[model samples]
Structure formats: structure tokens, C-alpha cells
Target: MARAKNVLWIMCDQLRYDYLGCTGHPSLKTPNIDAMAKRGVLFTNAYVQSPICGPSRMSFYTGRYMRSHGSHWNGWPLRVGEPTLGDHLKKIGVRNVLVGKTHMAPDLEGMKMLGIPPESIIGVHVAECGFEPYERDDGLHPTGRPRPKYDEYLRQQGFEATNPWEHWANSGAADDGSLQNGWLLVHADKAARVPDEHSETPYMTRRAMDFISEAETDGTPWCLHLSYIKPHWPYIAPEPYASMYSTADMIPVIRSERERQNPHPVFGAYMDMRYSRNMARDDAREKVIPTYMGLISQIDDQMGVLMKFLEARGLLETTMIVFTSDHGDYLGDHWMGEKDLFHEQSAKIPLIIIDPSREADATRGTRSDALVEAIDLAPTFVDYFGGKVPAHILEGRSLLPLLRGPTPPDWRKVAFSEYDYAMQDVRLKLNQPIERCRLFMVFDGRWKYIHASGFRPMLYDLETDPQEFVDRGDDPDCAGIIARLQAELFDWALHPNDHITTPREKIAAYADNQLQVKGGILIGIWDEAELAAIRDKIDQRAKM
Candidate 1:
């Protein structure tokens, strides 16, 4: 089959895997995303490597786990010399560009240490998480940092305000002429002060479409990362979307009394986090959930706009479209709000790949239960361009085989996710040491094991309790299962590729030399004739 010439990877921030209509959400209507799923292969068990933005996106871009990338938290730099999807794709003549947020922290310290100027082309690419920025919008600019470029654009468009990003885009005007930041629970029901078109979502969509239009004229193949920063925090939408859903439409909370009683220490810490604590209240859910749903609906509508534009431009037939999220918000699931936990609500993300190739015809509109991860996206993009995956560097396997009809026999059986809350204030307040503030999770289809440093592990049997209401980690009967899952986690922690930088041929040659030097399994004493032959061979090799 012919290769796809372009890749349109659309990523939404903090979008839940089951929020779409196709993913079995009864009330949330995501028709456009559902339609995309209908025309593609929707992975039912896709997970992120890390449940936070920067580290997760690093894994997605680098095709390596967060441990491999060494960027464990937001604002942490992806260490220098780490290869990314852009670094790999560019070798094969594909241009990868970012239209919106990557949450990539620039490696200024690394650059300084290496004496590489940050302004250099190579340095800029490394700092931007490997994509050439068509428009870099990380979205949140509350204070301390420079204002978002999108907000500046709004200011230029006659929407003048001291901080347009907050005052207009994310705030709702109070009746008494005060501005309420959308983050406040009271403003959850209020519409954004800005118009729908002027919001970050549509602005990003416009930039992506513009990039596609420009890329169509360019001769080289391209991958455009249209990363949208919506359905995220500061949950607010404009106009009709703000009033789109009522509190009655909100899905019932997924918490149970069993979860609240004797919760894991780390889990309890997350539960008491500001967002989680607030969201646990009934009043907060009543105010925030509808707005969150509205934001998602807004994203779906924007998808419709982009899809139509791509079709009109005649690019839809040749481009591969991938829709996914970095991580998912708990939305008060299991009594949590934001991600940073290994619960399905936070770790699992929606992944739909629409390969516009005839080979994918059989799998179109089908859902695959095969395990997938955020890191797989990079290798998939490389495979779509007909380039060989760099197996030595990338830990993820490509999804092309799954996207086609039959699944490979050796596909991954277990999914893994991780979170490092050491940098979070909650950990500090709890007096937990940095080294002991991390968690790792291993999950097969039916069972999950959560391993946290300096704390007892947590386990859940998904078949019996899909809501993850039970913690079986301490149960005596499940000891064997916990041990087995712990072994799995141990095996995964042993990164085989670590520190192996030599070429395979060189390593093989070294092995051969060792065997020869050691003279393994000598059958008999060398005769004078054999000694002469060996001496002659050695002399010949030395001369060469």
C-alpha cells in the first residue's frame, strides 16, 4: 500500500478516554470525535506513560517512557541529546511542526552546560520538544511568565485588557462588575467574556488549518501537531456552549464509601489536593461538570471545522489523522480531580488512528482491545512515512500492524503508567521525601497493580470492580497476584537499551573477538601444523 504523505496528529489536553459517545459515555455527546472513531481504529485500552502534561508529551514525542526521557514532571527539561519524533522524521524528509502547546520546558541549563546557544537552530528544535512551532501556545499564563501569544493576538484584535488571557478568555464578568476567574467554582456556570472564535481552541484550530494550507504547497511530507489546550482547567466556554449542558446531564460521581475508608496514604494525599478536595463537594460538581462537558463539545465542533477544511482542500484522503490526549482528568472520579494518579480516569486516554490507506479498510470503524501507550505514536508516525523504526532508541512498537486487520502475536499484554509527585507541594506538605513520592502502575486487562515508593501497593481487579473501588494490595489471598505484578513492574523498570550506545555490528564483533581470545571449547591440543596456521592467520590479521 502507498504511504500517507501527511500526518495530522490532534491532541487534546486532559480529555478523558470514555468522554466520547463511542467510548460508552451515555450523556456526553462528542459526535465529531465519534465520527472520527467510526472512520478509524479506536484503541480501547490506550494509556499514557505519565499522567502529567510535560513528561507525557515527552514520552509521546520521544517514543520513550518518561524514565527513558528523564523529564518526570512539568517544566522539567527533556535532557539534551534525546531524539524526538521530529529528529527522526526529519532524517527521512518529513517536516514536523507544532500548531499549539507542547508544554516543553527548554533545556537552558543543559544548553549552558554543553555550551550550545539556545538560539541556534538545533538548540531551538531540542527546546521545543522537536517540533518547529507554527504557533507555540502553552495556554496558561496566570502570572510570573510572559503572556501567551494568543492573548496578545486578542489584544491586537481590539479586545484590550491588562491580561486578556485571564480577564477575557478565562474569566466571567460578575453582575456587580467584578471579574471571576473561571477557576472559581462560582464562575463554572458563567460564559467566558471572550467570543467563541476568540478562545484558545478556535484560535489553535485556525492556526492548524493555516499550517495545512501552507504545507499543501510545500513539496516535503509533513506532520502537523494540532495540540488543543481545552477541556482543561480554567474550564470555561463561550456563548451557547457555556449553557449547552445542565447539571442534570453530569455523569454520576464514581466514588464509593469503600474508597474513602482507609485509603492509601499517597492516594489520600491526592484526594486532599486542592482540586480534588473542591471537586469532591456536590456543589462543585454541580457547577463545574457541565462547563467541562461544554468545553469538550466546543472541541468536537472545532474538529468538525478542521475536518471539513481538510476535506475541502483534498488533503483528507492522503493524510493520516490521529486523535488522542496526553492524559485524562479524574473529574471527581475516585474522589480525585486532576491527573497524577494511576486510576483509569487519569492514566487511560482516548486514541483513534484513521489511517487513510486501503490496508486499514478492514479495521475502520472497529475498536481494538490491544494494549497501546502514548509512546507508540512516534513510531507509528515513522512507520506511516515508510521509515524503519529506530528500535534501539524507541521503546514503543508501531501500531500500523494493529491498524490493519490482524493483531501481531507478540503485542504488549500489559499497559504501564507512572507519576512523580515529588515536586508537588502536597508531597512537601506531607513531609514525604522526593525519592519516595513516585508511583508506578502495571495493568493487564482484568487486573491492575499500583506500586508506590515508601507506601504499600494498591491493587484492583477490574473485572469484579471496574470502578476501582477496591484495593486488593493488602489482601492475603491476592498475595501471589501482587508478587507477579511486582515482578512485571521490575522487568519493565529494567530498560534494556540503557547505556548501550555502540553499534550492533561492533558489539557482535566484540563478542566474536571475546570468543576467539578465550578459545572456548577447544577440542584438542593444537598440533604443530595447526599452530603454524594460527600464527600465519594472526600475522595476516595484524598486517591488515
Candidate 2:
């Protein structure tokens, strides 16, 4: 089997694991994604390193924990010196490119401290999360963070506004000529005013195609991060997609009154928030969910288009296609409106990897229940390009073994995720300090444990209560299980993933090298005989 010449890493923002037909969606038909799953390995237990967009993506880019990277929230910059997937792949001749959203804020302070300019090649990579930004749009253009590229594109296409992204692309028009803002749940039923071809998804897909053409012309082996912003917020779709589904197509909302009653203090604070309370209403779900499903269907159609384009260019067979998400949207699940907690609907993401090599054929169409982390993709790409996985830097194991014949002997036993809510209103509602607003989750297939800083831990037995309708955190009967999971969580947290300066293997080689004695800094040398024996031993060891 030949190694893949390129990789097309596709990611949909806020897409859930179980929302696709491949992952058992009850009504939604996603044939394009489902076909990709059939041709690849569908990771059933894939979890993100963080539930939030920025930190989760940073983990995926660097193959390190959010805590290790120190970018704990949105708009927080990834440190300039941190190594990314692009940095690792470029060393082995893979040109890393980006077409859509990364949610990556640049470390301007760090870059300035080192006298690095934002326009230099290294500075550009650092600013864009190590990817060469063919077209980088973080996709959240409310008022302040306007994406100039997409906005200008929209205006060129005749959609004019102060911010066309927010005006036409994300808004719907009523018969009376008033704009229905997609930001409000009441207007989610209206189709977006933007045309299908002019929407963000199609535009980004075209950019990806354009990049592929240029890369092929230049004969550069590329890893394109073709990320889509839809199936995300402003849950309104354009044209046929908007009218595709109704309330009948919607699945029953996965929340319970029991969950709302006296929930964990941290969880309760989140539920009490405006978005959560709004989504908890029946009218809100009825109006917003179908539109959300439509947005997903629209993304699925765009996937079909992108796949066809790849195949027509004779690149499908040579490109290893990966489909996943930064994190999952709650969508009124567990009485939540956004992805900020450790429920399966929030942290568990859909991961499908199509290794185009013949060695992966045996595992094709198989679903792997092995615990997979979002950080694994970086090392997987490095391994696919025949580079050594630098354990001192990359904190994740490669998924190539899982895709090919031999499963790794030391596979991960638990999946981990994190959340930092200092900027959220939930923290203020709880009267918590900024430093104490951290949450960590550890899931070992059946038992899911969440450790909250300065609060009681939350526990759930997925084996017994798969829906997570019951919280066993305060139950005395679950003491032993909680204790074991806590120990495992602490064990994971104690590992020094941030120790990047010295390689462990290098340290191991330095053991008993007698450098102190060789440098004349011996602490306990008593006599000439002892010193002579030590010198002789050092010589023998060096020769061996």
C-alpha cells in the first residue's frame, strides 16, 4: 500500500456524534457523510480535549491538552512558540493549508516580545495556528470581528450591508421586506436571504477546491484543513434546505424535568442561564431545531459536492479524508443550549477517517469503540507522512495502527475533555472566582466522571443511565466508583505533557552517564581509589 499523497481534513463546527445517518440519526439523511463513514473507520468513542471552540481546536492543532497549551477560552491566543500539526508536517514536506474557520487567536504579546512580525512567513503561520491561510475565516462576525474576505465576497455577489455576513448570509427576509435575524430563535424558520451558492459553506468548499488545484499544479503534498462553519450558530439554511424538514422530522429533545431539578451546582448555574432556559422551552425547540437540521443537511449536500470535485480531479484515491468536529452542540440536550459541559451531546464528537492506503482496507467500514481523542489527528497525520512521532512534543498516540492491521498494545483506556467557564455568565451566577472556574471530564467507556474545581464532582454511569438523566454525584452508594475514577483523573492530570524541552528517551539515555564526576563535580569522592574505579567504569560503559 502506498502512502497517501495528501490529506483533506474536513471539520464541521458544533456537529454532534449521533446526528448523522452513519451514527444513527433517526430522521436526518446524510448520505455523503455516511458514505465516507462506510469507506473509513467511524470512531464511536471520540472525544474532544475541550468542549469550547477555541481551546478544543488548539488541542487538535497541537496534539496537547488545553491546560498544557494555556489557551483556555475563545479569543485567547495560542502561545507563539508551541508546535502545531503544520509545524510537524512541514518538516516532512507536507504543505499545511486552511480554507475555513480555525477559531485561532494569535499570540501577539508573545510574538512582539520575540520581535516577530505578523507578515513574516513564520509569523503568518503562528498567527493562523500554523496553517498557511489560503482563506481563514473564524466565522463569528457579529459586529467587532467582521471577516473582511467573506464580507467582500458577499458584496461582490450583490448582497450589500454593513456586515453582509450578519445581514444577508445569516438573516432571512420577510414578505414585508424586513430582515429576520437568525440570531433570534423566532426567525430560525425563515430561509436565509443569501443564495445557496453564495452561502459560507459553498464559498469555503470552493476555496478548498481552488487550493487543491493550485497544490496539484505546484506538485506540493498538502494537508488542507477544509473546515466548515455551518451546522453551527445562526441556525438558518438557504433555499431548498430551509424547506427540507419540519417539526415532524425533529427528534424528541433529550432533556428531562428530573435533570432540571436540583442539578449539580455548576450544572444548575448553566441551566439557569438565558440560552439554556430559552432552549428548554418547547416553542424554541420547535422553531429552531428543524432549521438546525436543515443547516446540517445543507452541509451534507456541500460535502457531496466537495467529494465529487475531489474524485473528478483524480485526487480522491490519493487523499486521506478525515471528517470530525471541534465539539458537539447541546441543542437543548441535558438542559443546555451550547457546548460547555461534559455530556455526550457536547464533548463527544463524530470522527471518521478514510485512509486511502490498501493497508487500511481491512478496517474499512468498521466502527472502532476504542477511546479516541481530538488530539490524535496531529500525530496520525505525522505518522501517515512517515515522520517519527515526537513524544516529547506531541501528547497523543497516532491512530494509524487502529486504521491498519495491528492494533496498538497500549491503547488509551479513557477519553478526556475540559472546560473553562470564567468568561461565561455561569461563573458569575455561581459567584466563583476566575481561577476556580475549571472543569475536567474523564470517561472510561462506562463511567463518566467530571471534576469541578472547588465543587463536588459529577458522576454518571453510562452503562446504567445512558441518557444521563440521573446524576449520581451525591449518592453514597457510588463512593467506590467515584474514588477509582477520581484516582484515574488525577493520574491523567499529573502527567507532564507540557514538558517539551527534554525528550524522555534522551533523559533515559543520560541515566548513569557519570557526567558530574566527568566534569569534576563529584559530591562524595573520598579517595583516589574510588575516583579511579569510577573513571574505569565510565570508560567501560562508554565503550559498551
Candidate 3:
């Protein structure tokens, strides 16, 4: 099978797996995304290593688990020297470029200690999550940062405000011409004051197109990470998109009364949080969900625009396209608001890959139920470009085999995810120390088990309770199942993820007494014959 010349990895922030039309959303009309899915392979059981944005994105970028990468939360920097998709692709002459959000915080302390300037080529790639940033915007500049290029663009477009992102792009206009903050759920149904073309989603899409054009002009094989920060928060859409959906289009909230009464200690603390409690209210759902759907609709339209541009430029046939999300928003599912949980709503993401190779044609419009993770994309990109995946560094196996043909018999049986709630108010509510605020989740297609560091483990039989409404953590009958799942987690944790410097082959050779055996300093040799026997066993080839 031949490989595509380039990769177009389009990502959406906080988009749920089931929210797209192709993925069983009854109300949300995502025709463009659905078309992409039909032209590719869509994964049904893809999950992120972490349910929050930064850690999850770090996992995706580095092809390592969150624990392996050591970036456990938002604003935490991925340490230097970690090989990312770009680093791997660069070995095979592919450039990885970014036109949108990565949520990658630079390791300033590490850089400073190493005496590396941020503007240095290596330093810039390290700062930008191993991508050449055509335009980097995290899309949540609420206050107190240097003015962004988007704000300058809004100014050039005659939109005036101290913070145009919050004003024209994120806020709504009241009847009296007053600005209504999109942060409030009451204002969620209101349209953003800015035009649709000037909004964040469209602006980022245009940037992505511009990048592709420039990349083609430069005659370089490139991977463009066109990440959109909509369908996220400040749940306000522009113009026609804002008015596209109504409360009737919103799906029924997945929460139940049982979840509210005497919930698990950690779960109850999350439910008690302001956002979760607000999302639990019917009024908040009425105002916010429709707007969230609208934001997604806008994203879908942008996808259509991007695809059409790619086709028009004769780039579609040569570019492998991947559409996915970093993580998912809870939207009040399991009595939670934002992501940071083990629920499918928060961790399971929509993954669609359209490999332009002829070998992928047979798998087009097919669905795979393989247990996939966000970290897998890095190795997939590396493999697609004919570069060997560094197994010691990358914990994820490439998904190319799954995409092109049948799943490997040794495919993973369980998917793993984690949450570091130490930064959350839930930690304070539980009165847990920093180290004990960790939560690890393991799911083997049917049963989902959560190991909370300081509390009882949470378990759910998804075979019987697909919605995950009932928590069987305290049930004595499920003790054996919990133990088995815990063992899976333990075995996964025991993997030496940080042992990346030495190749496994080299380690094995050393273990087999193959390290410097030909040297004269043979410790076990007693006589000339003993040394002769050891030297004979060694492959003495071309010593000079």
C-alpha cells in the first residue's frame, strides 16, 4: 500500500463521540463530518489518556500516556526531550504544522536551566508541542495576557473592544445593546455579536486553509493540525448557527436522582461544584445545550469548507485526513459539567481517519470497535510516513493495521484513562492530600472500573447499565471483577514508560551477555582457555 503525501489532522475541543450525526446523534446535523466518516474509518471505542484538555492533548502529541508524559493537568508543560509526532515525522521529511490550539504550556524552567532561548528553532518546537505554529491560539483568553493576533484581526475588521474575544466573539448583545457575557448559562442561547465569518471557528478554519496553501507552495510534505476551540465553552454561536437549534433539539440530560442522593465521596464533591450543579438544572440545560449544538453545527460547516478547499487545490487525493477531539464535555452526564472524569461522555472521543492510500479503500465507511487511545495518533503518523516507531518512547501502537485491514489479534483489550483532581475544589471537599487526588480508570469493553486513590473504587457493568447510572463500587458481589480490573491497572502502571533512552533490543543483548564480551577485561575468565571460550562465543567481526 502507498502512503499519502500529507496528513490533515483536524481536531475539535470538547466534542463528544456521540454528538456527531454519523455517531448516532439524532438531532445534531453534522453532514460534513458524517461525510468524512463515510469516506474513512470511524472508531467507536476511542478514549483519551486524560479527560482534561492539557494532559489529554499532551498524551496525543507525545504518543505516551499522561503518566508517562508527566503533564498531569492544564497549564502544565510537557518536559523537553520528549519526542512528539513532529519529531518522528521530521525524520522522514514531513513537517508538522499547527494553525490552532494545542494547550501546550512551554517548559520555561527547563528551557532556562538548559540556557535555551524560546526563539531558538529547537526551543520553539518544544514550546509549540513539536509543531511549527502558523498561528497558535488556545482560544480561552479571558483576561490578563498580551493581546492576541485574533484581537488585532477583530480590530482590523472594525470590531472595537479591549478584549474582542470576550466582547464581539464570545459575548451576546442584549435588547438594550448591552454586552451579555457568554460565560453565563442565561446568555448561552444568545448569538455572539460578531459575524459568523469573524468567529473563532471560522477564523481558525481560514488560517488552516492559508497554512495548507503556503505548505504546498513551499513544496514540503506537511501535517497540519487544524484544531478548533468551539463546541467548548462560552457556549455562544454566531448568527445563523446560534439560531439553528432550539431546546427541543437538545438530548435528555443523562443525570438521575439516584446520582444526586448519597453519591460516592469524590463523585458527590464534583456534583456539588458550581458548574456541575448548574448543568444539573433543567433551566441551564435548556439554555446551554442548544447553543452547544449550534457551536458544533458551525464546526461541521467549517469542516465542509476545509474539505472543499482541499479538493479544489488537488490536495484531497494526496492528504490523509483525520478528524477527532481531544476530550469530551460531560454536559451534565453523570452529574458533571466539564471533563475530568472516567465517564464515556468525558473520555471517549470521536476518531475518524481517512487514509488516502488504496489499501484503505476497502475499509471506507466501516466502523471499528477496537480499544483505541488518543496517544495512538503519533505512532500512526510516524508509521504512515515510513518512519519506524520508537517502541521504547511511544507506548501506543500504530492504528494503521486497524485502519487498513483486520485488527491485530494481540490488540489491546482494555482502554485506560486518568484524572488528576488535585487542582479542583473536589479535592478540598474530600479533604484529600495532593497525592491522593488521583483517579485511574480501566474499561474492558463491558465493565468500567475506577480506582480512586483516597476513596472506594467505582465500578459499573456497562453490559447491564450502558448509561453508567448505577455505581456498583460498594457491591460485594462485584469484588472479584474489581480486583481483576485493578490488576489490569497495576500491570499497566508497572510498564517502564520512562525508560526511553535504551532500546529494548540493546537491553536484551546485554541480558544475553552480549555487552562488550569481546573486550580483554572479561571478569569471569580464570585462564587463557576460559577467555578463549568466551571470545569464541562472541561475534568478533571487524574490530578495526
**Candidate topping TM-score:** 3
Choose 1 or 2, whichever is better by TM-score.
2
Give me the displacement of residue 432 in model 1, in angstroms: 2.6
lDDT of 1 at 529: 85
lDDT of each: 0.87, 0.89, 0.88
Give the alpha carbon lDDT tens digit for every residue of 181-235 in model 2.
8899888889999999999999999989988887776887889999998888888
- Model 1, position 134: C-alpha lDDT score: 84
Pairs of colliding residues, candidate 1 = none
**Candidate 2, which segments miss by more than 4 Å at Cα?**
1-4, 515-544
Q: For candidate 3, lDDT tens digit of each residue in 70-154? A: 8999999899887788888888899999888888989999999998899999889888889998888887769853338889999
The positional error of residue 216 in candidate 2, measured at the CA in angstroms, is 0.4
TM-score of 2: 0.96
Give the C-alpha lDDT of model 1.
0.87
Query: Lowest-lDDT window of 10 residues in candidate 1?
Result: 513-522
